[model samples]
Target: MKHKYAESDGTTRHVWDVERIWKLAEDLEPFEIHIEEIRGLDSVTWFYNGDEPTVRSVSRHAGRILNADTSLPPILTEDFRVFDGMHRIARHLMEGTSRILVKKFSTNPEPDLIEKL
Candidate 1:
């Protein structure tokens, strides 16, 4: 299904620059996570896991997902475990911007590999 993400009318202006984006680039940029081995939420059998978000230090990490509005890299993690470049996707959705650049990484991502972003 298609998601028509439109922001509130008569709202504040939105910014497209990712250089100094305190939300994603500034906070989650140069990001890295193990996608191949990162177990799924339901697969983990520990005391905490699943959609509940077991990771304890995920405040900053999750903030990036919640506030995001741009097209992000094709989910590097197994199933969207860690969302890189998500802020821009979120913002774009709210602002009705078309298209977003996303980079797909391998098991061991190459630091030099970068798309238009």
Candidate 2:
């Protein structure tokens, strides 16, 4: 899977290989972090576009959020950007959970691709 981050200019995309990052984090012990402390939560658009989310898009995320397995921890980078599992975090938040497990990479991985749109 590929994870995308919008560049400061908004037209550029930084894409990371989620599988590669997950592999790097597999051996790291998981730790708990307050749900509010996750930077990804600050942006209301991680799972889908907040500005104009389509019905299909919303439905897709709703299913993922509902089916998200909380037992598995979310993966984050050293700077706290989510590498994967945003839906799991969303599920925990919606359930009013204060804290959740996460695996953090000590170092950030380079983007597999970057492109300007």
Who wins the lDDT comparison? 2
Model 2 — which ten-residue stretch has the worst lDDT?
Answer: 1-10
Candidate 2 local lDDT, 10-103, one digit each (tens): 7877777888877778898999888887876877664444446778878888999999999999998787778788889889989999988899
Worst 10 residues of 1 by lDDT: 1-10
Each model's lDDT comes to 0.36, 0.80
For candidate 1, write residues 1-117 as lDDT tens digits. 121111113443222222222233323333433333332323422224244544664555456556774435433322343223444444444565554444333342212222231
Cα error, residue 74 of model 1, in Å, equals: 8.4
Index of the highest-TM-score prediction:
2
- Clash number for every model? 12, 0
Model 1 lDDT on a 0 to 1 scale: 0.36
